[model samples]
Target: MKKLHVVAAIIKKDDKILATQRGYGEFKGLWEFPGGKIEKGESKKEALIREIKEELNADIKIDKFALDLEWQYPNFYLYMSCYECSLESDLKLLEHMNGKWLGKDELDSVQWIEADIKVVNYLKENL
Candidate 1:
C-alpha cells in the first residue's frame, strides 16, 4: 500500500484543541486536525505552517512535536505528525465547513476522520 505523510497542527488555545470539519471531497463534514500532505522536498514544519495558513488563514508558531501515528485506511497508510501550535489570529475556516475548540468532555461530539481519530485518542490519553 502507498503511504501518505501528513503534518497536522493540534492548535491549542486556553486548553481547547482546534478541530476543522472537511468541507469538500470524500471526507466532507468529518473533523480533522488542520493540515495537508507533505509535498516532496518540503520539511514537515514547513508543510504544516503552509497548510495551516492555506486552510485557516492564520499564522502559527509550532511549539513542540506532540504525537506521531500511523493508521491503515482502505486505500492507503497514513503517517501523521501532530504538533502543538499557537495561532496568531482568530481562525477563519476557509477550507472547512466549520471548526470548534474541543475539550476532553466535548471530544466525542465531533465526527473525526479515521486517521485523525487515532490522534484524538492519543491526545485524550496524553493531555
Candidate 2:
C-alpha cells in the first residue's frame, strides 16, 4: 500500500474548532480539519501554513503539536500529524464548499471523513 504523509490543523477559536467540508475528490461533503499533504523537503509546519493559505486564504500560528496517527484506507495508508493552530486572519473558503465552527459538544453532529474521525475522538476527550 502507498503511504501518504499529511498534516491537519485543528484551528481553535474561543471554544470552537473549524471544520471544513470537502468539495472535491472521493470524499466530497465530508468534514475535516483543514490541512494537506507534506511536500518533500518541507517541514510539517511549513506545509500546513502553505496549505491553509492556499485553501482558506488565511494565516495561522501553529500553537503546538496535537496528535499523530496512522490510518489505513483501501488505497493508501495515511500518516497524519495534527497540530493545534490559532487563526491570524479571516478565512475565505477557496477549496472547501462549506465550513462550520463546532464546539466540543457538537463535533459529532457532522459526518467527518474516516481519517478525521480519530482526530475528532481525540478532541472529544481533550477539549
Candidate 3:
C-alpha cells in the first residue's frame, strides 16, 4: 500500500474547533480539520502553515502537537500529524465547501472523512 504523510491543524477559537467540508477530489463533502499533505523538504510545521494559508486563507499559531495517527484507506495508508492551533487572521474558504465551529460535545455531529474521525475522537477525549 502507498503511504501518505499529511499535517492537520486543529484550529481552536474559544471552545470550538474548525471543521471544513472538502470541496474537491475523492473526499468531497466529508468533514476534516483544515490542512493538507506535507511537501518535499518541508517540516511538518511549515507544511501545516502553508496548507492552512492555501486552503483557508488564514494564518495560524501552532500551539502543540496533538496526535500522530495512521489510518488505512482502501488505496493508501495515511499518516497524519495533528497540532493544536490558533487562527491569526480572518478565514476565507478557498478549498472547502463549508466550514463550522464545533465544540467538543459536537464533534460527532458531522460525517468526518474516515481518517479524520480518529482526530475527532482524540479531541473529544482530550478537549
RMSD in Å for candidate 2, one decimal? Answer: 0.6
Candidate 2 at residue 69, lDDT?
88
From the highest lDDT down, the ranking of the candidates is 2, 3, 1
Q: What lDDT does model 2 reach?
A: 0.96
Candidate 2 error regions (>4 Å):
none
Query: Which pairs of residues have clashing backbones in candidate 3?
Result: none
The number of clashing residue pairs in each candidate reads 0, 0, 0
Superposed model 3: Cα runs more than 4 Å off: none
Cα TM-score of candidate 3: 0.98
Against the unseen true structure, what C-alpha lDDT does each candidate score?
A: 0.91, 0.96, 0.95
**Tens-digit lDDT string for candidate 1 (23-116):** 9998998999999999999999999999999999999999999989988988889899889999888778899999999997788899899888
For model 3, the local distance difference test gives 0.95
Rank ordering of all candidates by TM-score, starting from the highest: 2, 3, 1
TM-score each candidate. 0.95, 0.98, 0.98
Q: Each model's RMSD to truth, in Å?
A: 1.0, 0.6, 0.7
- Per-residue alpha-carbon lDDT of candidate 2 for residues 58-106, written as tens digits (9 for 90 to 100): 9999999999989999999999999999999999999999999999999
Candidate 3 on 56-99: residue-level lDDT in tens?
99999999999999999899999999999999999999999999
